[model samples]
Target: MSEKLTLHKYQSDITGLMIEHKAFGVFAEPGTGKTPTSLYVVNHFRQKTLVIAPIRIAYSVWPPETKKWSDFNNIKTGLLHGLDKEQRFLDDSIGIYIINPEGLVWLESMVAKHKRFPFTNLIVDESAKFKSPSSKRFKALKRVIGLFKRRYILAGNPMPNSYMDLWAQIFLLDRGERLGRTISAYRNRFFTRGGFRGYEYFLRPGAEEEIKDLIKDICIFIKATDHLDLPKLVINDIRFDLPKGLRKKYRVMEKQLFWDLDEGKILASSAAVANSKCQQIAQGFLFESLSDKQKYDKVTKKVYDLHNIKIELLEELVDELNGSPLLVGYWFRPDYDKLKKAFPKAVYFADSSKSEAVQIEKDWNAGKIPLLIGNIASISHGLNLQKAGNHVCFYTMVWNYDMYDQFIKRVLRQGNDNDRVFVHRIIANKTMEEAMIMSMQDKSAMSSGFLNAINLYREKIKEYDE
Candidate 1:
């Protein structure tokens, strides 16, 4: 911790506000240095702090922030994860316990055995992950939250999809005084149920204004673009309809849960698997696993590709990029394999060795890599790839709002002062792609959360069918 940490006015302001409350939240947007700012405030209290963050972030972000600056060194930090890391939990020498959000369920059981919880301060980074009150991790943390003297929550996109996300997150901080004491109480006060199964919830009129005002006292909101001279984030939504033949094939493949093909056929085991094929085909490719491995001397599993329009778009997008590095987020292995073949020099930031990862990061930041292809799950969290280039295109999208939000900020965050980040989404019209895009961007800010977005997406699926 040799370097000094200097906070921007807004960063210091947010920390000051959180410090004033026994329990608080900082809803600062990405690139505003929430890690250091929150840590700076945590350092003042001089007590052990428990940090629960995204798995990748827990592995990379907090521990480095603590070591990079001189003040952070005073706090002993330990990252807890995996069965092999059991020693970290029992080790009393560590003052700051940073654990993956998934690890909380296990930690809860372990710490429950002890007479007292180990840490005094509990900080949830990307607190939006716990927005669902019924989730195992949220319930686990809720059981032990009261044990902490100072509890802080942080997320730039805290309510990424809707203001309703504020409830569970804020509930952990202040016990729902600002939202409601119970999940039902909170939802009932602000939302009216409708849509499919009457389970869909929308905010009552004027709910947004009143809700923000209610929680303003304890939650500090910071928009980085407001405070920093960041280049603009330009999003280009490229919508294309599937070809008539492909569209007909898509409908048939979706309904029958099977595809008749050359030399072999593809079959889906269940409804969920069939639904996934719809998503895959919507993204321009469908994978067919041929069960006839015995034909190849039992050596390899064969796969077939049904269609590919995204690859054509990738070619055009690359030409448009004109040598500027591109970050492509795709969902499946075929997408990865296709992108790798299209751009021979492209680097993938996936499950690579530590040495290979180091070179990938270096080459990307230096602008030597033409394309960096990754799944939304692979290239997110505390990794600073913003220095690479600002041209990011989402070849496909998934359901989680948190992953969608964080993946975009990878190149739009702090170090990207020079480039105007362009986030291009190649969405297939009248398909699940549109539904995924709409749910993520839906302005039902007052009531939408992951569960709400999922319902909204499913409702859109029916609309597409109609």
Candidate 2:
């Protein structure tokens, strides 16, 4: 039998705040029980709610969450995704209709065709995805905002890139009453363009405080550290030097934008492409083609193996763990392939079928899987694996702040049984891997716009003089 649902004091307080405001933003970190707290609000009103989340979360997270807590037993959730979504939409018994952000386009069309919207409340999980005003999902939701009487947005980092991200998300709640009527108005009011080609927007003096004050009534920012007594998180940077021959090749590629391999020439068409290639070399491999075709056409493009230092380091780390479950995050497909080859016992999360993935997750949480490997982009959100492990190793670094943050939270969350969580980062010294880590750290500290963060990252890389 499931245990009785009990809300933490902070959750209860947030619930009250949500109920009182009707339309609000719950900027609570992962594992902070935002889902249950929102469910409590939905149950209190007994209203039909529509939740927008990532596809994985829509299909896996919400329904189980409702069933997990006895307090939410009364809440019925139907996933409106995949081929059977239309059929599922016809079910009137579902109290909460869960759909991915992209599904909003279809939902908007349905509302227009039917000339009515059924949901009384709106809940957007990971609302940061809708931060862009120009995004199709945001536009779709804006068209039907009036259909929902009570609106709420939930996110751990709503402003994942910059404060500019808050405009569209906050617009969904109060229809731009708190921020501005449009993104341009919001930008003009709070920011000035300062970065390269006048593209990056920086906040003006006192704009942060003014903006915070305006949205203070509707937005509640909650940090997990402040509320949850989670275990101590220890981050370890395991640095290694690239092979001398590989090091020379890495510099040539960085300077010339192209490198000649015995098989074919590896090209970096632009700065971004060069950065990606640099990261690949740092991880000990280089792909023949710098095109998207390489991702799919496995037969045509050749992947040259540069070094095995990272794999060797990872094996050592696993040996040190002594058979304990270790969650490993990788970036590129080559990285996953190499990790799997090195540790044959490891299971790749993305390579598994639906049923297999479900079983893998079960085995992982049950402490049955020893080494679970996953692409950070794939498993960054929705799934919970904190029950079985407290140790995470980044086989390769990632540039996206949101993915990196969510990846760590997967293990360091509230349900872990351990008193400490260890995060091991395998970085190549004087390589793009170091630059990527520095970029992530700076972005986390500054919370600047994405492009601006990239520019800052490039400046840091230049200092390396590779």
Which candidate leads the pack in lDDT?
Answer: 2
Candidate 2 Cα errors over 4 Å, as ranges = 113-116, 253-274, 290-301, 353-356, 443-466
lDDT per prediction?
Answer: 0.75, 0.82
Top candidate by TM-score: 2
lDDT of 2 by residue, 1-466 (tens): 5457789999999999989987989998898988888888999999999999988777667887888888788878888877787766777888999999988888877767776667989999999899899999888888888878899999988876568888999999889888889999999999997543555577899999999999999999998999899989898999998888788888776655422311124311123344678888988888885445656654466799888899999999999999899999998889888987887767888787645766777789998988999989888887788999889999988766778888999988888879999999999887666656766676552424333454454566676564
Q: Pairing residues by index, what is the TM-score of model 1? A: 0.79
User: What are the C-alpha RMSDs, in order, of all predicted structures?
Assistant: 6.6, 4.9
Candidate 1 residue lDDT tens string, 1-466:
2898888888888888878888988888778898998888888887888999876677667776787799888788887876656678778888888888888877877776765567888899989889899999989888888889999998867765555677899899888777889989988999887643464567789998999899888888887778988878788987778888778777776545322311123221122233577787776666665556666644443445655677788889989889988888987787787777777767777656544655676678898988888888777655667887988889877665666777888888887856588999888876656656665775333333333454555565665562
Model 2: lDDT to the true structure: 0.82
